[model samples]
Target: MSDVRTKYKDIIEFYKTKNIAVLMGGLSSEREVSIRSGENVYNALVNLGFKVTKMDVDANIARKLIKDNIDVAVIMLHGKYGEDGVIQGVLELLGIPYTGCDVLTSAIGMNKIITKELLKAKGIPVADYVVLDPSNPDKSFNDILSLGLPVVLKPVDEGSSVGVEIIKEEDQLKGKLRNYLRRHPNSFAEKAIIGTEITIGVIGDQKNITILPIMELRPKKEFYDYEAKYTKGMTDFVIPAEISKEQEEKVIEYTKIAFKTLNCRGVVRFDAIISKDDGLPYFLEVNTIPGMTETSDIPAMAKAAGMSFEEVVLKLLEYVKW
Candidate 1:
């Protein structure tokens, strides 16, 4: 197996003289998860003999970045300000190179509805969905029913499945949706594709992309929610998902199309479900800044590809751009 430092020796040497900051712990719902992800990356970079610092992001992040003299930023923040274009825009103004997608890509990828729309237009097979309107709860409820019962509701702009829920019965639909809407006004309901839950990790820039082995996620809970995602043993991960070769090829093709359509760069994760009904993979959503924690799918996928956690960290840093 090739090592990250050995493969990108020049990039590693160049960053040796620079101050790298692992930005995490922002004011997002996924702040705790982000902090964990940041700590792992921070330790990985340190173990790899790189000059790295751990920084908790807040409203004064811009000033903090300047104070620390951060030459490069490895974004470990997951939701809201971190995953959205806000943090990326600030980095742009400060002229600091950062990992992951650019401002526009981050913005689009953060919003599930917009991301779906863009991918759908590019001929990607996304599950049928309807945007929830807070003002008209009844209308939103009706629209959700249109997608049929047993639908999945998710916040339009959240990661780690912060406010995701599944409505199984008609009796529990309206109440669940109303309460969910109250918390996350900007949400959407999508037809649930029952099958093997799978996700694929993609790395590299637009010119050259590498798709990691597809992993099947079997969450012990109702779905891959926050608890299932962060808690150890809450989910079982299967690499090279138990799917036919043809199905795997189609998923890879769709993933590439979605990756290029969103202009995604650095390390990103595309999640989907291979329908048991039709044996077809339905691309769910794109996670631009995938978690780097011990239990994260990205690390697991990288491990299956013969890359260590430290190597994955350095690999992402290699794609840093201003």
Candidate 2:
């Protein structure tokens, strides 16, 4: 923590003269979570003595940014327009630097299908899945059936497991999938990898990245859904996951490859599952703007690595480049 403070001391001092906005509470399914994250970050920046303001993103975000003269944005917005490159493109055009992955990366990272395809191309182990086009229910149902029962249905662009469903039987598949497609036209069906749920946190740029201690999530629910993620006492987090050292090494290696493959920047979280059958890790998806709330995974991993929440926020701020 001391080392990070020393390294970013100049950057911190430079930001003192700038108007930094903690962008949050965007129009997304994860708006409430984003607001919580933004509040924590806003408070940290205030306690650290930086000129910061809280910005709840809306259709008028551009005008608001201009009005406030925000020079930098610590984006705490998650899902939809916030994390799927829309806001990033706006920030890029506005010429205001912000934290986290760039425009293209955010777009790719938001779509599960595209993200998995890219990771698979890079030889990163990812679960087998098929794209579901809302235009064709027949093809979508058949493709999902081919993966066998007990598959996970995921919306391509949603975060926090929003609109995600688990189909265990064939009869339940058609109705649930059709209903899901009605809501989320762009989605995919993945062969559920039943195993230990793990998440890896990475910080810094491609050249100098830090993979924090791996975490294993024991969710009280059937899987780590939205409720399990944000609800208190719903999940037990284990740091330096109970996997073998070799397994840990493989996960970390895959994490590095995925980070660079996706062109991720600042802080990101990679979710994976260690298959109960083979005990090997299969990369799932990446969170470009990971939550900074009290129960967030990134903060827990950083704490395990001996970094305070404030120091992690500073480290994230240090990597802010347009």
Candidate 3:
């Protein structure tokens, strides 16, 4: 722990005049969530005595960033263009360091199909899934049905559980699937596993990775949907998830592999399902820029690991690279 503190000591001290920026509130379905996250982060930085600017980002973000002369940016945005490498690419070109993955990793991380394919290719366990195109949803039905009933449908390049649904009946599959696809343009289906849903928060980059305590999400609804996520008391979370040591170890192991394989930086949240049958952890997806909201799982896990919310925020800054 002393070594960890010493490693980040210089970075923390450098924030004295660093001209920090908290970029949030983009044009995504998760705009409101982003605003909430942004405010939380902005306040935290102020409380820590950092010179920070809070940005309700827009298409003219480049102009605003140039006007402010942002030294380093902390991304609190979610969904679509915000977390999907657009902002990251812009930051790269501007020669500014930002929290989270590089442009390549950010782009790949946003697309569910691409992320799953890469993870599976690396011998990581992922749930059975089939991609569906909005223009041609007819042919993918059979492939999806093969995965069995009660499948999970999610938008291809979205976050915060936006546009995610479950098809419990075969008859309702085609129409509902079409509507979701039409709305999202690129959505996919995965075989739903009935078991514990856990999210692991991994911090740092490469060799110095630190895995926070595992958080088990139990939504009042069937799954952790957008409503359950943002709405207060809509979900129940169990810290250090009530699993055997072996299961815990497997989750951590897979998390490390997923983080490194995706070339992630800063803090990331890896969501998974511990199968009820074989008790194996199936990698769902990775959030390259995990939320820093008041109720976000990453902060909760950090508290469990004996780190305050302010400390977690500072830790993310330590991993930023231009």
Using all chains and alpha carbons, the TM-scores for the candidates as numbered come to: 0.97, 0.96, 0.95
Give the TM-score (vs. native) of candidate 1: 0.97
- The residue pairs in collision within model 2 are none
What's the residue-level lDDT of 163 in candidate 1? 83
lDDT score of residue 137 within candidate 1: 87
Of the pair 1 and 2, which is ahead by TM-score? 1
Looking at model 1, report the run of 10 residues with the lowest lDDT sum.
Answer: 1-10
Candidate 2 versus the native: TM-score?
0.96
Which portions of model 3 miss their true places by more than 4 Å? 1-9
List, residue by residue over 1-322, the lDDT tens digit for candidate 3: 4544465577668887899999999898889989988898888888777899999778899998999988999998887777889999899889889988888898999998899989888787888888876777777777788889889988888888888888889889977777777787777889898798999998988878999989999999988988888888988889989888999998888788888899998888999999999999888899988887767888889989988777888877878885
Q: Report, for every candidate in turn, its global Cα lDDT versus the true structure.
A: 0.90, 0.90, 0.86
State which candidate has the highest lDDT. Answer: 2
lDDT of 2: 0.90
Residue pairs in candidate 3 whose N, alpha carbon or C atoms collide under 3 angstroms = none
Clashes of 1: 0
lDDT of 2 by residue, 1-322 (tens): 4566677789777888999999999999999999999999999898788999899999999999999999999999999888999999999999999989899999999988888889999888888898998888889999998988789988888988898888999889866777788898888899999999999999989799899999999999999998998989999999889999999998988899899989899999999999999988999899999999888899999999988888889878878884
